[model samples]
Target chain A: MTLCRYWRLDRHPEGNTRFERFLSLHEEACAPLAPGEVRIAVEWLSMDAGTRMWMSPRTDGYQPPLPLGSRMVGLVLGRVIESLDPAYPPGVRVRGFGQWADVATVVPALAGLEVVDETVADPRQHFGALGMNAWTALVGVREVAAVRPGEWLAVSAAAGATGSLACQIGRNLGARVVGIAGGAEKCRFLLDELGVDMAIDYRAEDVSARLSQVPGGVHAFFDNVGGPILDAVLGNMAHYGRVAICGMIAGYDSDVAMPGPAKFDQVLMRRLRIEGFFIPDFLERGAEFLPQLRTWLDEGRLAVRFDETQGLENVPAAYERMLTGRNIGKVIVRL
Target chain B: MTLCRYWRLDRHPEGNTRFERFLSLHEEACAPLAPGEVRIAVEWLSMDAGTRMWMSPRTDGYQPPLPLGSRMVGLVLGRVIESLDPAYPPGVRVRGFGQWADVATVVPALAGLEVVDETVADPRQHFGALGMNAWTALVGVREVAAVRPGEWLAVSAAAGATGSLACQIGRNLGARVVGIAGGAEKCRFLLDELGVDMAIDYRAEDVSARLSQVPGGVHAFFDNVGGPILDAVLGNMAHYGRVAICGMIAGYDSDVAMPGPAKFDQVLMRRLRIEGFFIPDFLERGAEFLPQLRTWLDEGRLAVRFDETQGLENVPAAYERMLTGRNIGKVIVRL
Candidate 1:
C-alpha cells in the first residue's frame, strides 16, 4: 500500500474562499493499480483562479462543482511509477487531470492522460506558458478575437499567466498590444518585459481615460478580470470590435451575485462580438499550437514567468494568492 | 413650389418620447430639383425600434443624434415626380433615407437613393420584409449566429419584425425554432403562421421554465429585447451557444438606466458567443440576399406580416405602438 496525501472539499465556499476552512488535508492508502491503470507520483500541480470557481456550487456551464468530501480536481504533472497501460509505461512523464496528491492511481483512459516530451528544457513550462494558458491565449487571439495587424488589442490581467502570453501573441500577430495590470511594477514588467505598446496601471489610473488617448480605440479586448474593467473597455471599443472572455477572476470570490456589465449597451452600438471559450474545446489543435509555441520560446519571442510555492501543503495559499493577484504569471505548487 | 408637411426634431426626448412636445410639424415650400437632384412624392415609410435609439443623446455607434430643428432620419419609398438626373427619371420608384414628408427634393448622391424595382406585388414590401428587417434577420442567423440543423434556436421578441423573420430563417436553415413574444395572440401567430416549433408567451409563461423543456438547451438566441428576457435565455443556454444582438426595445423608452443582463456570467461558463451587429454593415451583400429573399417569398417558404398604420400624420403613434410591443409585425406608415 502507498500513502497518498491530498486535499478534499470540506464545504462549499460562500463568498471568497477561506481555503483552510473549505479544504481539508487527508491521507489515504492507495491499492495496487488495476487493469489499464497507471500509478503516478505527482511533481507539479497547477493552481489557477478557476480552481476557486470549482469549489462553489455549480451555477454556470463550467465543470460541475466538486462533491463535498471528494478529492479536489486539478491538473497534475507526474512520473509513472507503475503502469498496466502500454502507452504510459513506467518512467514516462505524463500530464492529466487528477486529485491534488503526491500519489495518484488513475485509469489512463478515464484520466485522459497525455505523455509529456522529456526533451523540453523545463517540463514545468508545459503547465505554464506552453500548456492550457498558451492554448487559451492563442484560441482567444487567433480564433475568437482574430487579432489582425494594426489593430489595437487590450488585455486585462496583463501580468498574469494567460494575459502575459496573450500580450506576446497579440504583438507577434502585429497588433498594437496594450495591457491593463494592477500596479506600477506590473505595468513596468508589461512594457519592459512583455514589450506591450502601452500598459495601463488600472489601480492608479482611470482605464477609460487612458484608453481614450489611444489613437484609434481598441479593436479587440482580452478579458480575464471581468467587472468594471470589462465595462471600461466596452465604452472604448472601436466599431465592429471583438472581445474574447477567458476568465472573470474579479467576481469569483463575491458571495453576492455580481452585476452585469453596465456598458453592455455599447455592445449593440459599437457592433462588438464577445465570445467565451474553454481550452479543452480546442485541444484538437494542440499539435498545430505546440510546435509554434516551441519555436517562439526558442527564439526568445515568447516569455513565461511563474509565481511558485513549494510543497502540497501550500496549494490552498497559492490558490488564494492567485485569486487576489498577489502572484504574477502562472501560480504553481511544486509537489 | 410644392408645400411639403414634415416632422422635425423640436427638442430631445426626455424619457418615453412625447412626440407632441419633441417633434414639430412644419409646412415647407419645397425647392425645385437642382442639378442631379430628384423630387420624390414620399409614399411609404418604415418605422423601427432603431428610430427611437437615433433620437436619444448619442450613446452608441449608431447614427448621430438628430440635431434639434432637423428633419428626422428614416427609410422611405417614393415615386420620382421630377428629376434632372437621367439615372432617375420621373415615375421611377426610389428608396433611400429621407425626411418624414409629403415630398422631398434630394440629390441622388446625397440621399443615397437607389431606384427600386416595381415588379414586386407590393412596393411596400421593400420597406418591410424585403428591406432592412429581412436583411438584419438573415445576417444574424446565417452570418453571425450560424444556426445549423438539429439546433434549438430561442428568439426574444420572436413575434416582432426581425424576430419573426429570423424564426422562419432558422426553420428554413433546418433548426428547431422557439419564439418568445409578448402576448397569446402573437404566440399563436408564431406557431400557426410562422411555423415555429415552439412559442412562449413571455407575458404569461415562465420563459426559463418553458425553455428548460427543450431537449437540448438553446443553441442560439436572437435577442431583440435585451433585459430580463435576455437574462432568462442566458440561464438556459447550451454549451457554445451563440447570441445575435439585433435590437433592445426594452430600454429604448426607459427614463432610468437599464441594468445589464443579470445572468450574463453564463456567457463565460457556457463558452457562448454574443455578437451585436447593424444591418447597414451587411448591406453590401444585399445583391446576394435580395434574389434569395425574392425566391423564398415566391415559394411561400417565407412570409411577411405588417402592422401598418395609414398616413404619415400618425407616424408618431405608429412608432409609439411599436415601442410598446402593440404592433405584431413590421410597423409601417402609408403616406
Candidate 2:
C-alpha cells in the first residue's frame, strides 16, 4: 500500500487558517478507477489566491463546496500510474485540475492529461509560467476584455503568478502595462524585474492619485485583487473600457463585511464591460492556445517565473505564502 | 409676436419639484439661425421619465443639467418654417431633439433629422415606436445582452414605453418574454394588449419567488425600474446572463436617502453581465434599425401607443403625471 500525505483543514480559523498536516491518505481513499479513468502520481502542485476564495463559503459562481478534510483544489503535474482510458496511458505526464496531494487518481474525462514532450527544458515549467495561471491570464484578458494594443492595461496583485503573466501578455500584445501591488518590493519587482511600464505600490500610494498619472484612461483593467483598487481603476477607465474579473485576492483572506463599496456610476459613464471567468471553461481552446503560447515562450516573447517550495510537506506553507503575498510569480510545491 | 406657453423650472426644487408653466414668445425667444440652420414650428413634444433624471443634480452620468431658465430639452415633431441649409427646406416635416416650446430653431448639422413618413400610419408613432425609448429598448436588450432566441427575457416596468417595446423585441427574437409591472392593470395590459408571454404584477407577487417559477433562470434582464425589482432579477440570473440597464425610473426622482440600494453580490456569483446604453450612441445604426422597425410597425407586428396631454401649457402637469406612472407609452404634448 502506498502512502500519500495531505494538508487538511482541522478547523477553519475565524480570521485565517494555516494549512496543517492531518491524517495521511491510503490507497483505499481513492475509489477504484472505472473505465475512462487514470491514476496519477502527482509531481507538482500549484497554489493561487483564487483557491483561498474557495476555502470559504463562496458567494461567487464557483464549484461544489471545498470539503473540510481534503486536499485543496489546484493544478497538478503528474505521471500516470495506471490507466483505464486510451487518451492517458501509464508513465505519461499530464497536468490538470487536481488535489494538492502526492497522488491523485482522476478520470480521463475530467483530466487535461497530455503527453509531455521529453524535449521540454524542465517539468516544473509546466506548473509555472506555462500552466493554469498563465493560461488564465492570457485568456481572461484577451478573450474576455478583447484588449487592443497601445491601450492601457492595469493589473492588481501584480507580483502574483497570474498578474506577472498578465503584465507580459499585455506588453507583448502592445498594451502599456501598469501593475498595482501591495508593497514596494512587489511593486519594484513588477516594474524593474518583470519590465512592466509602471507599478503602483498600493500600500504606499493613493491608487486614485496614481491612476491620474496615466494620461489616457485605462482601456482595460485586469482585476486580480478586487476591492478599493478595482474602484480606483473604474474611475479612470476610458469610454468603452473592459474589466476582466480574474480573481479577488485582496478580500479573499479577510471576511470583509462587503466586497467593494464604490458606486458603479463609472460603469455607465465609461460604458464599460465586465466579465468574470474560471479557466476550466476554456479547456477546449487550450489546444488552440498552447501552440501559440509555446511559440511565444520559445521565442522569448513570453516569460514565466515561480516561487517554489520543495516537497509535499511544504505544500501547506506554500499555500499560506501564496495568500500572504510572500511569493512572487507562480507558487508551486515541488516533489 | 405670437404667444407660445412653455414649462420652465420656476425654481430648482430642493428635493422633488412640481413642474410649473409660464407664457413665452413663439418666435422672438428663438435664437436667430446661423449659416446651415433651420427653424421649426413645433407640433408635438415627447415626454419621458428620463426628464426627471435630467433635472436632478448631475451626481452620476444620468444627464447634463437643464439650464436654470431655459426650455426643457425634448424631442419635437414639427414642420421646418425656415431653412438656411440646403439639406432642409421650408414645409418639410421632421423630428429632432428640440425644446418643449411651440417654435424652435436647429442647426443644419441637426438636419437629416428623423422625419415622419406621411405614407405611414400615425405622426406620434415616430416619437414612441421608432424614437429614442424604442431604440434604447432594442439596443439595450439585443446588442448589450446578445440575447439568444430560446432564452428567457425578463423586463421590469413592463407597461413603460421602453419596457413594452423590449417585450415585443424579445418576442420578435423568439424568446419567452416575462414582464414585471407594478399593478394588475399594467400586468393585464402587458399580457392582454401587448400579448407578452408572461406578466407578473410585482406588487401582488413575490418577485424573487415568482422568478423561480420561470423554468430556467433568466437569460437576459431589461431593468427599467431599478430597485427591489432589479435585486430579484439579479438573484436569479443564470450563468453568463446579461442585464440591460435601460432606466432607473423608480429612483430618478428619489431623495438621496431613498436611492435604490442594489445587491451586487449576485453580479459576481452568477458571472452575469450588466450594460447601460444611451440612444445617441446607436444613431449610426439607425439606418439599419429604422427600416426594419418601420416594417414591423406597418405589418402590425409592432404597436406604438401614447398618453397625449393637450396643450404645451400642460407640460409641467404632464411631467408630474408622467413621473407618477399615471401616463403610459410616450407622453406627448400637442400644440
Candidate 3:
C-alpha cells in the first residue's frame, strides 16, 4: 500500500478563503484498485474560482457546498499507476474531477474520467487552452452569443484563463476582439500574442469611455470579472447586443454583497440578452468543440498560458493570487 | 376643408407627464388626399408606457424621443374616408402609427398603414389582444423564454395590459402560472378571471418568500414591471431559468434613478438567461402569430380586456392612470 496525501475541508471559508485554517492536510494508505477501477498519481490540479465557491458556507448557489471533513473537490490531470479496467491501462493519462490529493482512485463508470489522447503533446494545455476554458469560451461566443462576423466583441479579464481563450475564439469567429486586462503587460500580450484588435488597460482607463471610442460599440461581451465592468459594458453595448456571464471573480472573496449593474436600464434600451452559463451544462458540446480546438493548437493559432506553482502544498497561495488578479492566466498546481 | 384636432408635444415631460402643459390641443384644416395618399378618421388610440418613454427628454433610448413640436406618436385604428391609393380606398379600415387626431392624412407608402379586414367585428381588439400587447407577450413567452409545458412561469404586473395576456399565453403553452400584481383586486382578477395558478399581492406579501414555497421554483419569468419585483423573482428562479423583459413600467415615471435587482448574483448562481426585447423587433413573425391569435379569439380561447375611455380628450387622464397601475388590461381612447 502507498500513502496518499490529501487536503480535506475542515471548515467553511469566511470572505477570502483562509485556506490554511479551513483545509487540513492528511495522509492515508491508498486502497488497492478494485474491479473496473483505476489508481491515478495526480500530476496537475486546476485551481479555479469555482473551488472557492464550493468552500463557502452559502447553501444557495450554482453548486452545492463541499461537505466538511471530506476531501476538497477539483479537476486533475493524472497518470494511471494501477488499473483493473481494460479501457484505462496502467501508464495511460486521464483527466477528470477528483480530490485535491496526491493519489486518486477512480472508478471508470462512476468517476467522470476520460483518457487523454496519446497524440496530445502537453496535458497542461488540456487544462488551459484546449479544455474546459476553451470549451466554455466556444459555448459562450458561438452557441449562446452567436457572434456574427465583423461584430465587436469585448472580453473582461482578457488575460485570465477563460477570458484569454474567449478573446482568441472571438477573433477566430471573425469578430473584432477588444481585450480588457489589468496591467499594461497583459494588455500588450493580448494585442501581440492573442492577436486581439484592441486591448484596453481597464486599471488605467475608463472602460466605458474606451468602448465609446470604438466605431460601432461592443456587439457582444464575454465577461469573467463582473460588477462595475459589467455596468460599463452594458452602457456601451450596441443595439441588440449579447452578454455571456461566465464568472464573477471580483466579488468572490468579498463579504459584502456586490452591487448589481447601475446601467441595467441599458439592457432595456439596447435590447440586450444577458446569459449566465456553467461549463458542465455544455459538456456534451465538447465533442463538437475539441476538433476545432486541437486544429487551432496544432496550427499555432491558439496559445496556452499557465501560472504554475511547484507543489500541491502551494495551491492555497496560487489560489489567493488568482483571486486577487495577480496571476496572468490559468492557475495550476503541478505535483 | 375639414378641421382636424390633435395633441402636439410642446415640451419634454419631467417626472409624471403634465399633459396639460406639455401637450397642447391644436386644430388645423385637414390636407386633401393627394395621389398615393389616404385620409383616415381616427377611431381608437392606444395609450402605452412607451408613450411616456417617448415623452421623456432622455436622448439615449430604444426609439428617439418624439420630435419636439410634432404630434405625439401613437398607434391608431382609423377608417379611410377619402383615398387616392388603390389599396386603401374610401370605406376601408386601417391600423398604423399615427398622431392622436380626429382625422389623419396618410401617404400609404410613407405611413406604415395596413388595411384592416372588414370581417373583424371589433377593431379595438386589434389595438390590444391582437396588436402590440399580445404580440409582445407572445414573443417574450414563446420565443425569448421558450417556456416549456409544466414549467412554472411567473409574470410581473399580472393584471396590466401585456401582463394579463402573458399570463394567458403562459397557460396556453401549458405552463403553471404565478402572477404578481399590485392590489387584492388585481390578484383576485388574475386567479378568477385569468386562470393563474397562484397570485402574489406584491403590495402586501413578500414576493420572494411566496416564491420560495413554490415547488421546484419558477422555471421562467415574463417581466413587464421591473424594480424590486425583478429582484424578488431573480432570488427564487430555478437553475437554468429564463427571464424575458418586455417592459419596466415601474421606473418609467421615477424622477430619481431606479435601483437594479439586488439578487443579481442569483443570475450567475442559477445560470439564468435574462433578455430584453421589443415587439417591433419580431414583426416578421407576425404572419405566424396573427393566424393563431385570430383562431384563439374566434374560439373564445383568448379574451380581450380593454379599459376604454369615452373620448380622445380623456386620453391624458387614461394614460396617467395606466402609468400608475390604476387601469387594468389595455388602456384605449375611443375617438
Candidate 4:
C-alpha cells in the first residue's frame, strides 16, 4: 500500500488569516480507486485564491463550503498512476480539481479531469499558458468584459496568475491595459514584463486619482481583488464600461460577505455593467478557447512566472503567499 | 407679458429630506425664446425620484448635479403655445424636460422634446404609457433585465411609476413577478390591481426570507430603491440572473453616496449580471418601443394610477410624497 500525504480541513477559519490552524497535514494509506475514479501522482499543486471560500462556513458561497475533516481541495497537475475511468488512463499527464496532496484520487467528471498536451517546452505549462488561468483570461478579456480594440482595459491583481495572463490577453486584443496590484515590484512586473500601458501600485498609490487620469476613463475592467479597489475602478469607469469579476480575494477570507463598492452609484451614473463570472462555469467551452491560447503561447505572447514551493508541506505557505499578494505570479507547490 | 413662477435651486441640499428649504419659487417676466426654443403651457409636472440626485451637490451623479440657481428641471406635459422651432408647432400637445412653472421654456434638442400623441384616451397617459417612465420600464424590464417568459422577476419600489409599470410588463412578457413595496396598501395594490405573481410589504416582512421561498431563485431583478432592498434581492438571485437598475431612490437624497449592497459578493456567487441604464440614453429608441407600449395600453394590459397634487405650490409636497414612498403609482403636480 502506498502512503498519501494531504491537507485536511480541521475547522472553519474565522478572521484575517489562519491557514495553518484550520488545516492540518495528514498521511494515510492510499485507498483503492472507486468506480469512475482516477488516482494521480501529483507533481504540482496550483494555489488558487477562489478555493479560500470553501474554507468558510458560509453556505451562500459559489458552492457549499468544504465540510470539517474533509481533504482541502485545489487544482492539481500530475501524471495518472492508476484509473478506473478509461478516459484518464495511467501515464497521461492531466490537470484539474483535486486535493492538495502528494497522491490525489479524483472522480474524472467531478474533477474536470483531462489529459494535457505533452508537446509543450515545459510540463508546467499545463498550469500556465494552456491552463484554466489562461482560459479565464481569454474568455474574460474577450467575451465577459467584451473589451474592444483601442479601449482601455484595467485588471486588478495584475501580478497574479489570472491577472497577468489577462493583461497580456488585453494587449493581444489590441486594448490598452492598466494593471493594478500591491507593491512596486508587481507594478514593475506589470509594466516591464507584461508591457501593460499603465501600472498602479494600489498599496501606495491613490488608485482613484490615477484611474481618473485615464484619457476617457477605463472602458473595461477584469477584476480579481474586490473591495476598496473595486470602488476605485467603479468611480473612474467611462460611460457604458463593463466589469468582469474574476475573483474577490479581498473579501474571500471573511465570514461576512463584503459590502459592495462605495461608488456603486457610478454604475447608474456611468451606465456601467458589472458581471461576475466563475471559470468553472465556462469549462465546457475550454476546447473552443484552447486554439487562441495555444497560438498566443506559441507566439510567446502569454508567459507565466511560476513561484514554486518545494513539497506538499509548503502548500499552505505558498497559498498564503499568493493570497496575501506576496507572490508576483502563479504560486505552485512542487509535490 | 407672461409671469413665470418657477422653482429655483437656490442652494445644494443636505440631510435626508429638504424639498422646500433648498428650492424657492421665484416670479419673473417671461423672456424671448432662444433660437430652437419652444415654450409650453405646463399642465403637469411629473415627480420623479431620479431628479432627487440633482438636488445634491455631488458631481458624480448621472449628470453633474443641476447647476445651483438654475430652474429645477423635470418632465412636463402641456400644449406648446410658442415656438421658434417649426417642428413643434403652436397648439401641439408635447412632453419633454422643462422647468417647474406655469409657462415652461425649453430648447427642443436638450430637453428631448417630442410631440406626443393627442389621440390617447387621456393626456396623462403621455406621462404614463407613452411617457419616459413607460419607456424606462420597457427598456429596463425587457432589455436590461432581459426577463424571459416563465422566469421569476422581482421588482423593488413596486408601487412607484417605473416599478409599477415594470411589474405589468414582466407579466405581459409571461414572466412571474414578485413586487416588493413599502406598505401593505402598496402590496395590496400590487397584488389586487397589478396582478403581480407575488407581493411583499418590505416594511412588514423579511424580504430575504420571502424571496428565498421562490422555487428557483429570482432570475431577474428590476431595482429602483437600492440599499438593503438590493442586498435582499442579491442574496436570492438565481445563477446567471440579470439586474436592471432603473433607480436607486433609497440613496438619491443622501449627500454622501449610499453604501452598496451588503451582500455584494452574491454577484460573483450567483454569477449575476448587474447593469444600469438611463432612459435618456434610450430616448431615441422610443419610437421602436412605442408600438409595443401603445399596443399594451390599447389591449388594457397596461394601466396607470396617477396620484395627483393640485397646483404648482403643492409640487414640493407631491415630490416629497413620491420620494418618501408615501404615494402610489405615478405622482404628478398640476400647474
Residue B272, candidate 1: how far off, in angstroms? 0.6
User: Where is model 4 more than 4 Å wrong at Cα?
Assistant: A14-18, B15-18
| Residue-wise C-alpha lDDT for candidate 2, range B50-153, written one tens digit per residue | 66655655655554666566766677889988878766688888888777788766764443375567766677877877777778888987889777899999
| Local accuracy of candidate 1 as per-residue lDDT tens digits, B178-251 | 99999999999999999999999989999889989988799999998899899889888898899999988788
Q: Clashes in model 1: which pairs?
A: none
TM-score per model over all chains = 0.97, 0.92, 0.95, 0.98
Candidate numbers, best TM-score first, in rank order: 4, 1, 3, 2
Over B1-335, each residue of candidate 4 has an lDDT whose tens digit, in order, gives 87899999988876546579988999999999989899999999999988888878888888888889999999999999999999999999889999888899999989999998877978998888778999999999999999999999999999899889999999999999999998999999999999998999999999999999998899999999889999999989999999999888888777888898898899899899999999999889999999999999999999899999999888888988988889899999987
DockQ winner between candidates 1 and 3:
1
Tens-digit lDDT track for model 3 on B72-191? Answer: 878788898888888887888888777888787777655667776567788787886788788998899988888999999999988988899899989988999999999999999999
- Go through the candidates in order and give each one's DockQ: 0.71, 0.36, 0.67, 0.87
Best by lDDT: 4
Candidate 3, residues A264-315, lDDT tens digits: the string is: 7777888999988888777766778899999988988778789999888887
lDDT per residue for candidate 2 within A115-136, as digits (tens), equals: 6665568777676556777788
**Which of the predicted structures, 1 or 2, would earn the higher DockQ when compared with the native?**
1
Worst 10 residues of 4 chain A by lDDT: A13-22
Steric collisions counted per model: 0, 0, 0, 0
Clashing pairs in 4: none
> Which ranges in model 3 have alpha carbons more than 4 Å from their true place?
A15-18, A31-38, A83-86, A106-111, A255-257, B31-37, B82-84, B105-111, B255-257
Say which candidate scores most in DockQ: 4
By DockQ rank, best first, the candidates go 4, 1, 3, 2
* TM-score computed on alpha carbons, candidate 2: 0.92
Q: Which CAPRI category fits model 2?
A: acceptable
Off by over 4 Å in 1: A255-257, B107-110, B255-257
Whole-model lDDT for model 1 versus the true structure? 0.85
